[model samples]
Target: MSSYADLLKTPGVARIIAAQLTARFPNGMLSLAYLLHVERATGSYGAAGLVLAATSVGQAIAGPLTSRWMGRWGMRPVLSLTLVVCVLSMAGIAFLPLEVWGYMAIGFVGGLATPPVQPAVRTIYPKMVTSRQLTPLFSLDASAQEIIWVAAPVVTTFIATQISTVLAIVVAMVFMVGGGAWFIASPEVGRVRIPRSKRAFGVVLRRPPVLLSTVVGFLLIGACAAVEAAVVATFGHGGPESGIVLAIFAIGSLAGGLALGHIPVGPWAMTRRMLIVFIGMAGVVFWLDFWWLSVWLLIAGIGIAPALAVMFAIVSSSVKFSDTAEAYGWVGTGQLIGAALGSAVAGFLIDGYGATGGYLTAAAIALLGVIVSAVFKRAHPDLRGRDASPIPDTEPVPVQPS
Candidate 1:
């Protein structure tokens, strides 16, 4: 707690974190909003899902390219361009009376223009604080992100159900424009410059820690998405219990991150944290009651933030400053793909085997994450007693003629 407090006290730290979180809040709202809006318009979950899938695909494709572009073109221009396009696309979706294909096309375009806020903020963090503070910053960040998962859905649900789905999206757009403006105007955006990578695009994925983090993150988030779908399926009948349970889950994550963030990270740190999640989720499989599921998921939530913190720290330590943005881009992409795949698989399984199938799918994904982390323990950088800053970019001197 003292460490986190100190981190917030650092200049630019609190402001940047708050601004980015606010800007990124739409990530939490837009998914549900899109589902409801498109479903209402097209009269089919299938069509809505196609729109969502198209949007996710556009986001995935955009993450790396846009992040790298920040290095080549500069943050303000790239972010400003994306922000304007993204806003227009959301408006098009809300206002345009189009066929399902039209919605999908616009959604895909919106995704492509999704601002690379996550990667940008993360890239800037290393420059904001001391090396020792970096790990805790990442931990604080991972924990703080739970606020989005917890509140955004509730806000979106209230607006969409009580007022209108279109209004919910409009609200999201407002946050995007407002928060994006705050973040872009920050002095740090002008201060830190990501050195352009000399290597070709996608070359950063070759780093072991980046690859390890991406694979593990994919599985971890997949498990989380599975659990979310299963919970909704279990309590989707004329009640708000599902929302309450998911909020509890996010709360648990927030608590765990604050409590365990100061602990030194070792090669096995992620494995241990993930094991806590696996054990808790495994308990949910045996008992399907509402109380039992909530209890188990809350326990699983304990490991979520801490594991993510490790991923960020490991990647930061392993990549050069020039490549950090692109590396985080790939990591973000993996999580996006994981969310899409996890929900799709959980839906298929639930249709066949009931809610238990979803829980089972979640547990299976967590188990795989555990396996990957454990087998490749060497790939995770031991951050204990070491600075977790990005390696400085270097250039070779031109050879003098003999």
Candidate 2:
């Protein structure tokens, strides 16, 4: 029996995870660093909040855009090229004079160039790891991301305070470049290229759970985005407090992610609990009617990682070896679209109406995800039972190779 690490010999999975972890670790740090920079420059919480919002908006839009590159060029080219672009973008942000557009541009480039790491990672599993082992592996990956991103703030904050505000941002940039480069430098995974003209994109969409999981991911992101926007505004009351609310949510998720990974939490059992938890949290946003936004967000935030880890594990299991990137790309596309929409709507509603509007919007979308998941399950009960059967007989009628 091979050890856990031995099973992960797929060059693609290891490279992709390395790139993603490095990229996200600093990207995670950027939030706190950005918040500080904005506050210091403008001396206003509202101003900083706007900056952060723009950053979030930019990143959300980037996911699918980057995923397309992943689908077309394969992980190596996509990851490498994106890293270069991100580095330049960060440099621009660091050196350019203080202004909202400057920051937005910086954020945009970073988002646009980011590798669709999750999809790449998922794509490699069928080849790198055994079918029965997928759940635990994905769990480990998800858990790693949570830990890195969660604690990254401490280092980021310290760097920003010690060296310069821009140093933290610069470090984020450098990390992406170096790490992403390293991932692709290994020929094993990077060597596997996807031809640009491989069948129509719709072909992949035809897959059952692939499409279903992707759609679910998108709707879920929409709900979460709304929650993010609303909770920040609600607990924060204006600007300075936004960081605290985000921190609360992130910390809760950190704990949840680790538990989902290490604990023998039954995959299906945890999933059901997550679904129930999602609805309950959505309900809490309105039911409690509490002015203290922190408490509401903290209570609901614990579900974030556990829910994602479950979804990812399910997604990893759903696709064939060939369809990994495509499946993952669709998932990213869903999230990108949902998050952008959520952020835009949240901004408008919060700016005009209030926190309640944003919260209601988030809750409604989350409910829709739950409803959609149910509908999909009902519609494709065949798939609900079909993947277990052997790979549909692919043997060709007798043909002579001559």
Candidate 3:
């Protein structure tokens, strides 16, 4: 196999991605499914909206709780648990005749049990490839997620149209089971704990780079989620093709992330130039509510994966290998919290002001990321190009010379 394809053969990396693809494939269909069930059973958008809120709550809380499991029992057990929970959740929704409340309950449980794939992918990346090769690899992962998000929904939608939605969900469940079992068989994932006796929360929380990175992730994810909700609401009812603009928006992000992820940059790369990226990325988002929404969004989306990969690489590089799970978990949690906040707020804002309100609100929130990055540069003159994470096993990260 070629070097790029070789990632698929890597024991741990391959399995982790497989599990991610499996566990998350159905996520694309979730919004549509909620709409279908709620409208079908309760005959009102109000009840459907309420159920979607419950799902968001479940997903938001799931990150932290699962983080604890990943910290304690390690990836294998957590991966297993995620698969089981995902499978069971799908089954309940599939086999049972659900009332509106029942649908809400299932959606909540399903969201809560969703796997923390991005963090897992990050923790294993440094191990899967050389330090220098990490960026492109992460970019590929980001790109793959967008591709999956696009494809999965189309596939599920087709199946539901042809056969039944339940059958489509069952297909998603099979992918999870098959992929989860395969991941467990990998050699690299284990429960070995690295030495860190200090409080994990205190040490990680106080670190400045971590704080900055978490803040940026929070703002970016919020903007993305808000856009997602807004697009769904705004372009809704156009036709069967009405919802496709989201796929286009995501494709833009995927393209941008791929460019950023795969192309190698010089050292201290993101520190000096991030502001330009921040402004441009946030600005294009403001008017992304029209026929041209997808095009601008594509431009806006391009900066995301690259910038995010840079921050995540920096975060991983700064922490001890032992704390990778929790550190990434915290960042993930912040992003999730932001997404949750953005989604919740979009409903209120859109209802009051209009669909355009959502676009403006999301952009304004993302601008905070630009402000935070600027403040970081001003306050910390001494902290440039610093990958704070100590290399593991007392073996210095040679490329880093740390």
Candidate 4:
């Protein structure tokens, strides 16, 4: 706790974290918003799933490309442009009276323009604090991000159910505009310049740790996405229980992240954390009652942030400073892909087999993640007693006249 206090006390650390969290808050809201909005409009969860899938595909493509662009073009310009395009797309989804295809098209466009806020903020963390502080910072960031999960669902559900689903999306856009502006205006975003990678694109995937993190992160988030769709489907017609349950789940994640943030990360750390999630989610399949689902999900949520923090630290420790942005980009892309597949598969299953299908999908994805993490224990960097900062890029100095 003292370490976290010190990290927060560092200039611009708290501000940047807060601003970025606020800016990225929409990431939490949009999936559920789209799910409910499209489901109501098109009268099918499968159609809603398609829209979410399209948006995530766009995001998957954008993650690496946009993050790399920040290195060449600068953060403010790239972020500012994406912010405008993304907001407009969100508006289109809310206001445009179009067929399911129209919504899918706009969702894809919106995803392509998804701001690289996660990558940007993460890249800035290395510059903000000491090497020793870096891992804890990652832990803190991961844990804190649960705030988005905690609040976004509750708020989105309330609005979508009580007022209108369209209004829920409008509120998300407002957060995007306000929070994106705040993040862009922050000094650290301007201060930290991501060095252009000398390595060609896609080269970062060659690193074992980066690849391992990307794979495990894909499975982990896919499991999470499945749970989310399941929760909404279970309680979407039952009032605010969906929001409350999801928020409770996020609260559990926040608690776990904060409690486990200072613990040393070993090669098997991710596997251990993922097992916790798998066990909890596996338990969820036995009972579909409201209380039963919430309790199991709360337990599952406890492992989410800790697993994510480990992934972030491992990637940061493995890559060069110049390649960090792109590495994180690939990592983000994996998660988005996971979300897309998880949501789509879960939606289809829910339509056929009911909420049980969604829970089963989540448990299966989580179990797979655990197995992958354990098998690749050799690839997970032992961060204990080691610096977690990005490898400094070596520049070639010109030879002077001898």
Candidate topping TM-score: 1
TM-score of each: 0.97, 0.72, 0.81, 0.92
C-alpha displacement of 372 in model 2, angstroms? 1.3
Report the C-alpha lDDT of model 1 over 1-402, residue by residue, as the tens digit: 899999999998999999999999999999999999999998999999999999999999998899999889888889999999999999999989999999999999999999999999999999899998999999999999999999999999999999999999999999999999999998888777777789899999999999999999999999999999999989884798999889989998999999889998999999999998898888898877879988998999999999999999999999998899999999999999999999999999999999999999999999999999999998988889999999987863121121
CA-lDDT, candidates in order: 0.93, 0.61, 0.65, 0.90
Cα deviation of 65, candidate 2, in Å: 5.5
Q: Relative to the unseen true structure, what is the C-alpha lDDT of residue 302 in candidate 4, on a scale of 0 to 100?
A: 89
- Model 4: lDDT of residue 391: 87
The reply for model 3, stretches above 4 Å from the true place, is 1-19, 190-203, 240-242, 262-291, 378-390, 393-402
| Top candidate when judged by lDDT against the true structure | 1
Candidate 2 CA-lDDT value: 0.61
Models ranked on lDDT = 1, 4, 3, 2
Between candidates 2 and 3, the one scoring higher on TM-score is 3
lDDT of 3 by residue, 1-402 (tens): 144466566555666666666656666666666555456567888888778778777876776467556656667667778768867987887778878789789878988887765565577677666654565666677667776667877777677667876777677777667756655554545423334323445467566656766778788788777777777667675454435776776777677765555445444444433443345445544565455675666666666666576666666666667566667767777887787788878878888877677777677776776667666743222323333233564533222110
**Candidate 4 per-residue lDDT over residues 1-402, each given as its tens digit:** 999999999988999899999999999899989999999999998899789888988999999999999877878889999999999999999988889899999999999999999999998899889988998899999999988878887789889988999999999999999999999999877777777777888999999999999999999999998998898888876587877788888888998888888898999899999999999899999988889988998899989999999999999999988788888999999998898788879989999999889999999999999999999899999989999999887873222121
**Worst 10-residue lDDT window, candidate 3:** 393-402
